[model samples]
Target chain A: MATKSVAKKQVETPDGLTEIRWHGRGGQGAVTAAKMVAELALGQHKYFQAFPEYGPERSGAPIVAFTRVSDEPIQVYAGIEHPQIVVVLDPSLLSIVDVTKGAPDDAIVLVNSEMSPTELRKHYGLEGFRYYTIAATRIAVETIRRPIPNTPMVGALTRITGLFPIENVVNFLREDFGKKFPPKVVEGNINAITRSYEEVQGE
Target chain B: MATTDRDILAVTGNEATAEAMCQIDPDVVCAYPITPQTEVVQLYAQMVADGRVASEFVTVESEHSAMSAVIGSAAGGARTMTATSSQGFALMWEVLFVAASYRLPVVMTTVNRALSGPINIHCDHSDTMGGRDTGWVQLYGENHQEAYDNCIQSVRIAESMDVRLPTMHMYDGYVISGAIGPLQMLTKDEVQQFIGPYRSINPMLDTKKPVTVGPFDGLHGWYFEHKVAQNRAMDRALQVIQDVADEYAELSGRQYGLLDPYRLEDAEIAIVVVGSTAGTTRMTVDKLRARGVKAGMVRVRAFRPFPHEAFAQALQHVKVVGVMDRADSFGAMGGPVFLEIRAALYDCDPRPQVLPFIYGLGGRDIFPDNIEQAFAQLEDVAKSKKRASSERRYLNLRAD
Candidate 1:
């Protein structure tokens, strides 16, 4: 007899889970973003899991990190083979890696790019899929005075999935940054998140 | 202060284990940086640097010196801990037995990784399995939460009166070490109160009662008796492990046991597994159960004591058993876990047909499908009442 005693939870999203795979360089915070999204989901009382695929890579080498958000305990610990959403923190990774390798046709593909999603869809011929583009790097540079797009991409992710309220994401950032950085640095990241949340476009 | 919030945080297995270390606040933490295991030390070092913990953070040059330094501190009656993996653990081979034999209650977190020849840095039980008989009580974790909890409980288990043995807790290198998951955090006060204070026995620092540690044994010395005493401590550790786990459950409301048996009540075919792969095995078992197959899993949480009686009792009803070992013992009849499981059930009146499967070596990914295939093989064996075709089986292997 199976003991099914898991306390059911109500999350903001449908389908019970939103598994995401993030593609980025070693120095870029794809792993950090994956962790942050998992934290955001946890803060909202949802179950989540995140992890990075580590290789013998130097600073600029390509990497992949994965995150899974669910209303129930996640049992899968293997690497993500088929993600419901693929978020590319590095647009340069597109040419080399198959960013949408095992994604279903209706999977959402979010990229940190200067080009619009419609143009990106036309360029990549991503038919029968949801494509999103956000100028996260530009937003980060404008607000945080750096090129790290992870924080901005978090904003875009929250906005796109509606997984958690943007305020909750910002509040998590505020607490996380407040512990490590000064108020000004925290504000810079908050602005980056809010700006990208407003500017993220999808088709 | 004391935090009663019990808020869940999304954290990597390394980060969660380190947080438990910080909360425990040992006297010394001596560790060297190594892949997979490096992040645990790095996070703990940051905690020490930021004054979150008073643990004397000793940055050692090599894994050997790291274990040596902890041995010295632990002998000096200081609560000491460290973290290492793979080759680093291989480097600390000489001192591992020394720590255990000296009856030092030191705790070490071994992020399980493959000992290298091809220089791979991934999840496997090779390193810890290599030191299986080093006399330290070994606890394996199946997820980030278990990793965190084991780190905290290792202290109390090691320091227990009846079991003054050094303890090593392990989780899969990249799978649990690098994976991020949500886990509840106990306040600093809760951990401090749970672990309490460390009481030293035969401490080197007590000049008035000066005693020798690691003294040479002559031809007529009681070295044989010392070895027997160590074995006694290991046997005593089983009870201490259960006691500590029970108390921890009362404090956190989350209980852990020597073995995690899932859907095994009336199982005809079952799999015995360890570490993070058990999570995958459970999912596969659930899927098979849905199809009217009585598939079950027993995840061995405590590997050192082997939990022979508990395991034998759990497998009483099963007709076929599959023992999954992530690390293989070359030339041996079966893997380390398989050998132990077979030995545990040796005296049963009607023993189950046990099959040994070697898998996930060098951090190879074992998906749910691979686990299902293993269960499928077990189902066939259960149906036929015949032994599996191969003496040693390898799962998820690629053929050229």
Candidate 2:
């Protein structure tokens, strides 16, 4: 049976709320990235919600997570059918899932890809949405010594959307990661974020 | 409302409830690991190990043993608690009645999930709905904030001297349990003051006042009387629930009523629902209202001691009402919520035509359009002055 309602037409999201959907695989920090956006919103005195569309819990499986940031309290608990921003944490998911499904024509689609935005769009025959691309996986490997692209994707999303200042996110990550990880690991993630922020390409 | 000082934090429903549990710092928490609810136990155990709480965390073998241990601890004059979902809740079936009958205020967080034949771990109310008559006071929350608030208030409601019955607050499994949402939190000092000290009644550990618990109530025993008394406490609980909620509102600046009615006063058509679906329904109501439809919603926060009077009063003005239930009662008149609501409106002077809608079972999504269709049906019922059918209808269910 189909699990979600298929939107036949554009559904307007609630006023003053920015809805975002994240596409990634299990064990790739997509859920974590979704939650980090919420935490960033909390720091701005905005209300936020982040939740994953949970299927079977397994590594390497395709996963989707959602985040909503609003100036007012968020009351709706439905899955985001029309996200204003769609972030692709894994480039491999682009082939299997329509990451842009249900999003508006003007929605910002950010992907962690080595190709430039124009080249990536042409390569996939993508249209109608503004695309932003970054070598997020390469950046993560170079700085964080890992292949997880979620943090770098977050940095690119921040730069592409201009939701908040890059320095603020840096400070937030430092304080947040400082509590959980060692100094080296925190610094590595911070480097990965700033590098991705500077290298992301969009028109 | 008082201007209270509160900390706003981003946390999942499980994390929020765990924080509440830590703040309350009960004497003993006996729980086993179960999905959706496992995080509550895991987080609370971390707190206990980290010395953030003084509560004794007992890891039991199964949900049955978890409930059994909580009963024993609460009977022995300890403020006890537990958390479970779906199959875990089903496993606690037999011991649930014993905890309620013994009049122990054993507070529990039952993250609502579907019971399994095909072994699904998703959001549904079948688990809690199945235990509706288990004699436990049930409170449902729409999201993480309400779950946190309900968790804190449940202690006071359950431990009320006049109404000492076990309480279980529920939220949609995974939807709320694993979802991170912003919550305004009371400090540890504030929580401790709000709940006050735990008072133990007929303590088995008390040397001077010796009491026998779980005694054999044979054919000549006051078993029926005991049941009546239990029912009386449940009846008294309605008031206690309100009183505690009122007090909580004063301290937290967030108001809660037995029924949360939105735009229902002047509504021509309305929907009555529970849990996270209430949020989605509210959005639908807003959307329909924008298009000049007099749509409204009444979300039932308190399910057990099922707020019949409140429901009737809130929905009496509407011409048609649709009752949404996440769980179905096999071969019944309709779903549990629908039956209760239909019965509640029976004595109305101009009784509204109520329709039954079963939706979102086994974690099926009920989007805004589906709710709009329900409201459309209600409109049709209002225009024709006829019932849609004698059978229960479904939202977003596949016919094929």
Candidate 3:
């Protein structure tokens, strides 16, 4: 058997499935981000599942959502216990909740903070994981003129993981926005996503 | 527009069910919003507002009124439909019997949730399992795609001349209802071509043909005989359900049946499950199979007209069977499904000692490990020829 620390550092599973967990507050569009990512993956002909874990759903209450992308159809319907990637939609949740719970030692942790990877690693004790930081909230305010960091974080995720073509996310946003929002709002969100994709930094 | 060849879309089970409702284009939809189930009606409401569907969308004050309105709409020569969950279903309990007895083909999508005492708004089978005897044709789905397919197939089953009973197809609340997954959709034209048009016969409000509905039946009346006819219709429903499922499979290439058995052939021990947990159990069965253990599963997709003959035939060869019930039967011998399965398997020559496993009450998550533990118990029962331990056991319960 592998040693405990060695096992903690090893994150590979036999199945080639990628599971992601999102940390955000209520009303921050974390669930929508999970849904959009799943939708984008489905558009690329990949099997995906996205779901939110709810608890006393009040605005600003700590929320957690999950997304799983797989080559084959996903059959397990329970909550994701060990996520390979953890996306934090709310920087303030870093202090409030244990946002890194169940993350593997080699997991990628993405956060919507203005801090650099080195600074966040020092401040939040992010020692054993690959950390990526992006100013998603600032990007959202500059583009969408709102503090909703969902779209920007999605862009940052695209860069950090390179899980799929960014064009897939752009096309999804365009089609979804065409249905719901005005052209101005749609262009703004699209720019927010694009800018965040270029601006995200990792270590 | 006809969707060509399994157009895969990301959708929650609620959205998938409501999308099917939109395609069916029912004459009337009466609904009241509740947690988990509220999204199905909310999406359908938006579709109605956007003129996407021509159904009369009735926003009722409460679930009772919602069901009552549907009953009235169904009686007035319309293809009526509705959706509800948990306490909403409990509130519709009285009207459910009336709708079933009157032979109204009212379709309902019941997102299964735990009933309220402490008032949890999470997933469980207690709500619909309580209504198992309400004379409605009940179907369970393991995921979003199944929920969508079941919703479309239900319309054809309910509206058939031989079986005019209402249908309630359920997926787990939050788990399947709120979770987004890949769902293949049939085009609106394909759904229309499959179900065809609704032609209501013996409508109460028809001017040319006068008909009386739900008059009070005295001791001398045929109320008892009406119930017998309802039972006969339910019996006939088994065949109709299979026929409709086969026809649907031909159209969409997605097949469903009375019960979905996974690797049950030549297996000594098996576990029977319902709703979304069956997906998790299937994965666990695969793991046990790889380890050279003969583990199999039988998922009861259609529970209302409890497929007794089919179940007995499936389980007759097995040495031991585990019935996983998400709802407790309280003081009964075991859970409701366990009792039913036990009764169904009584006459088998080598009768399997069916163990009762109550699990997932009040939205407790049933993981693959928990399922593996159940299979281990089933293996133990298989090894020991005599009865073991308690008659009823709870899986994944934290005793601490």
Candidate 4:
């Protein structure tokens, strides 16, 4: 009777949803991460609700973004529990708030760290199911030369959790980066995403 | 039952309210959902996703953000709506007054659930009462159909341009919030034609056109003007209700405006109640009628700025009015509704001997049998000192 539970959607709602909780630093692109996920889901013609819950959390201070996605439309809008997946863009968050609390025991936890796959598993007690980490920060500093690993971590997030297709994530990066940044920045971001996906933990 | 309109569907009170909101067709809906009230927002979100409605569903973090988002959107000249109940409603207290004072025609549906200290999620008037003076026009709905119908009517009442104030459409939390029933609804085309496009007030957010709102520094006289204008706008809402109800009835073959009377035609004793509590009162009224007692019920529907004229007119022939309040105001009179009802009927010609009875707080099941029991307080007041209980009997709390 050990049937595998299918990968649950981060936001169950197309518009109103169950709830999605994000735990990341201010400059780590946590809020932007939630929005990108929202726009990505929207592009799939799925209904989604996404917003950030921030206090005076300055850069590197943990900020949260919540997304409630559902097929039937979501309404329980306090915070998230029973979240389908959790995107921890900053791997250092493991010592802070319990990111796993809102997640189901069988949920996916995608992190950005230089720790080896075996080292990550040994270092942290990920008891129930799937867990992942990618050296997204190093790639961002090396490739993008910007302290912003938001896009690279997003790549690791997609590669590890399978929440969005890798190809779709690339298209999203191209479009999102093209908005404010120049063409070179867009190419740099796309390059960072591709490199991060290859460097993601696991085989 | 007559053949239902396309927009008509037998749904819960909250769902009805949502359907009406959909009929009114808001441009933005941002909400942090609570039980009972959640369905209203959920239905709108569903409509947005399914292409049944085209509106920006601003999914928010809390009731605070939800209320704030709608305030900004409404101020920016878009019809906006949100829904919450009980604790959720209380949480939005910070921004509820903002929506009102800013004169944004924001339509919010509050499924009237009891406030929590003991943590109950049933029907009561306490939640809505907590929001009474937030400057929003508050209208109470009696049943599922009324909940569905009044939401449509309230939009016209609250957003008449002249009455560009927010409205909180109140329905009983679980009693009507979840109960499904038949309702007459307007056709989509008829609805669209009836409300037309929402023309926002002067000064929307445009870089080309600069405007300031809700600034910290406002002159004292300017504040007075805002209050006076808002008060006068509420007066315009009264007229808008009359016009919209007349128009909606014509297009959809259904009628609604202000108070709905069950009896009170040449009666001496009448019980007044609001929201789903009125349903129980009606059953008691029938029982009272069968017993050969000339007793009736007046379910107060329109509560904001109060239907002072309509209520005075309703109580014209009655000699005794039993006001059953679902919320206690600590030491003032009896219940939230009772105090307001008494205030409205104060200047009446030979005002009825009004008695206030407090019952149904914190989501307790209020039985129909208790309606007469509570109304009997009027007779008891006549016989002995009904004012002996320090104005509250603590029906749910300790009887002390």
Candidate 5:
């Protein structure tokens, strides 16, 4: 029998969704960061999706990943054409790729760099959006003892978007990291998140 | 609807499937690594190494060997499983039929990928669609949650007494397999209880009832009768698939069927699709519906035992139906799915004009705009009541 009783549950979020694009080089943990943000949203009972733009994945190659978060179940699997937020994990990618290619006028653009938001805007000739900057790699090196900027960038994004509280992200990271990493490594990541959250500078 | 207490886990489709496999904890799992699909077995291997599962993890040299090993284990009266994609699936083509013909209830996850010519490793339905005739019960999943659910249900469907055929559940490579999404998971205890225990039939391992498997069929042999019996099991699978889905719904609060129809009851135009694109098509249908367009979509969840009756009944009142296929059928009128859907509607009293759409080949993107365009074309056919071109239409293809 063709059963019509099992109607697919479609929850509609009144305010739509937040779509984010992450620009990073291969091996920089762009995909991991994208997934981390989505995972954080999942903890809040928000529907989320994260995926990388698949290609010949080689180290140092420019790559992009995306995340969509909504209060409703996300049904669209298409690539994000106009992202509400764009995160640049590697500052070098800014010159190579148009990281803000499809961003709207009011989109939030976050970058991992030592430059201030104004300096980044003028240096990269980037404009028409709220630009934020943080020395994520420096923070990661100081805390996590690694140059991987993904964790710090996640911190900056959490602070910039205020999507969830900083303490909530910290607690989530503590529990998540505790399961897989040694005590020192777990504390290092927590420090990276807290440090970046404090040091991130934006308008 | 009854609901099971579930935990929401954010994971990729591969992760979800591997998690289900950990829950199923079959007697044997033989696998070879391939792009996108590599993560599933890798995770499962970790489970096996961590002593989380009691299954023997066979690290085969190749996909052919992986399928061969699973068949051997299944024939030896063990619950066996495997996973593969693209070239790996092509390598297992011969053994795929062997497992099915031998009636070994070996469950597998065929992460859909485009077959290599230019040597691409990305999502497309080509690999599995190529093996559609290999006598395996095929199920397609639209997302990670469905992929997880289907992986669990596949064990029950394939191991069912009336439908003891090898089964493969497919999800788009990289799209679902590698992408992270939300999934509500069933506990390991619930899964074990749901699928029950592995029951051996005509066991080769049983000394009291030793049976020969894969015996050569000569001109005098019952090869023809055996083929007929296999087809009969496939016919029985249509019901068994539904019954399992019904029981799964009672346990999980999520329901599935042979076909997942959306807004098709009084539609003037509809599109039939499979895999991840179904979600995109559903969103498109909703967008069109908001503007008063009678748009509908039916996602083919089970492809091998094609639901002809359900399709005919669901799409009977529609004026035009568009069938979307991600893989081409070479010189055929359209894609494999289009051919089946058009044939399914052959007996309609007031036959609706069916159009063939071939899209997303070699992992090309199929946006909502592309699906919206297809619906617009269908709406045109419905309004004019004129036969559209029989030529296969291409979505999101460059015309230069």
Candidate 6:
């Protein structure tokens, strides 16, 4: 609950079952992000339930997709209220939604923001939660050549939390993308994921 | 002077009626139970264990699955049944209508209970009211005797070749389901002859003539065609209700169809009611008539295809019609009964202005005194010519 922004080092707890809530507009591959993560965990032999909660939502309307991974069978049925981690694909959404409203004090926040964590707090006020900022759009554009931030943010989430090995995350992406996309697109996404993971600055 | 025939031995109404359903030997029975209705499934399981009823009882996880499995079993052309009430009934809303739309002819018994905000597990009409328009023919049983009798007849009505839409038999969850009283059961041979083996039109699982089920389709394509076909089948079911009720009554010696009236020969004021409330309302009408007040009772036994002509005739010469409902329609001009009763009177040249009184909600005990109170409320409405609330109000809301 410290007020200062600082990068976090590689640390492991006994069992930190990380849950990720993705905030994006419709048709932004946010649900695809959730599915990819679920597929990743399944390939790694870690059980997960990744699902989208939508009811007649229109395009460009804000939507949230969810993912849960744990050592035990998940019994809690309610949607993620206070997420351990939050991923915002669109930086423009920060002004409209208070994404950090119910974020736990010990939670880690990830955003596709170029704004410094200090500047972000001065305007948005981080409320002293640990957070990481990544320019996923920039990474997606430079490496993947697409506006979709799903793969790049997956990399940021993987690097920031070290929720699992980077190789495992990459391997998951390769397996999931291989069936659908061409080899070039898959390789480009893999590059974007790796680059975002390398650049994600955590607190 | 005791007859050795069927009479109530001491047992809970839920246990007795559930055992009766098991006695019918359903091919598939899937259910998810709410408060008072849980014992219905529990008794069915016990019957299954004791080898009294030989049927594959699928103890499903949710009321959703309870209905889902019934749809599958019924589509596979099995004589299937399920039981639920309250939130459980609400949860099955999606599939409940599907069973009818597919014309599976499934029979469901709503061991009626109160719906929740602050939940109560007692007898009321709210549980079954949510499903009034699932195209399923809805029937209400007054007491435990009717509960036992109707569960068997319901199967016959639902699965009959003429009436292929689903059917729901509703009885008060606690008032009937929990109460134990003098009950009579139909003999095995009698029930067996009444409900013949299932003969379905189009079964999905049969390999000899297999047809696809539950497929997604284009609106102008397969979906629209199947929906239109369902509408025609439901119209046919309206006639079947009369056909089955007549035949069953002759066989069993118990009279039931819809809208049983009590002494409305030439009354100016008629009270039209539904479910167990009709029984009490009849007593109130009797007391009112004894006091030199012109009063009569109309008991609505069926709630679908809504005995409109029959119900209207019951109110032929009545000046004022008091419609009392155990549940509210919420944000409508009248209670659920008030809407239909008023609609029935809409065409008559000299029709009674139906006044609605919503009462006995959430299984709040509606006694003989409560019935008189409802009559008084209706009198006040008739005098004032205005409703207390256009939006539904809690009938017996205790003053805290």
Q: Rank all candidate structures by their TM-score, best first, as comma-separated numbers.
A: 2, 5, 3, 1, 4, 6
lDDT of 4 by residue, A1-203 (tens): 11244333352222334345677888887777676666666555444555565355587788877664445422222235566667777877877777877465556666777886567767764444466677777888877888677788777766765556878877877877788889888888888888988888762
Ranking by lDDT: 5, 2, 3, 1, 6, 4
Displacement of the residue B199 alpha carbon in candidate 5, Å: 1.3
Cα TM-score of candidate 6:
0.63
Candidate 6 per-residue lDDT over residues B302-330, each given as its tens digit: 78758788887778677777787888877
Model 3 agreement with the true structure over B326-382: per-residue lDDT tens digits: 998789988888998999999999788899999988888887778989999889889
Better of 3 and 4 by TM-score: 3
Model 1 RMSD to the real structure? Answer: 5.4
TM-score of chain B of each: 0.98, 0.98, 0.98, 0.91, 0.98, 0.92
lDDT (tens digit, per residue) of candidate 5 on B1-400: 6554467889999999999999999999999999979999999999999999999999889999999999999999999999999999999999999999999999999999999899988888999999999999999999999999999999999999999999999999988998999888888999999999899898789998878988888999999899999999999999999999999998889999999999998899999999999999998998899999999999999999888898899998989999999998999999999999899999999998899999998899888889999999998888884688889989999989
TM-score on alpha carbons, each prediction: 0.92, 0.97, 0.95, 0.63, 0.95, 0.63
- Candidate 3 residue pairs that clash: none
DockQ of 1: 0.66
Instruction: Please give, as one word, the docking class of candidate 2.
Output: medium
Q: Which candidate ranks first by TM-score, i.e. highest?
A: 2
Off by over 4 Å in 1: A1-15, A182-185, B1-5
Best of the candidates, DockQ: 3
Worst-scoring 10-residue span by lDDT in model 5 chain B: B1-10
| Model 4 spans > 4 angstroms off | A1-203, B1-9, B206-208, B219-221, B379-390, B393-400
What is the per-residue lDDT of model 1 for residues A75-188, given as tens digits with 9 covering 90 to 100?
878888778899998888877898877676567888999999878766765455578899999999999999999999999988989999998988988888899999999999
The lDDT per prediction is: 0.88, 0.91, 0.90, 0.72, 0.91, 0.74
Global Cα RMSD, each model: 5.4, 3.0, 2.5, 15.1, 6.1, 20.0
Give the TM-score (vs. native) of candidate 5. Answer: 0.95
- Residues B34-107 of candidate 4 have per-residue lDDT tens digits of 87677777778889888887888899999988899998898787888888988988989988888899988888
Off by over 4 Å in 2: A1-10
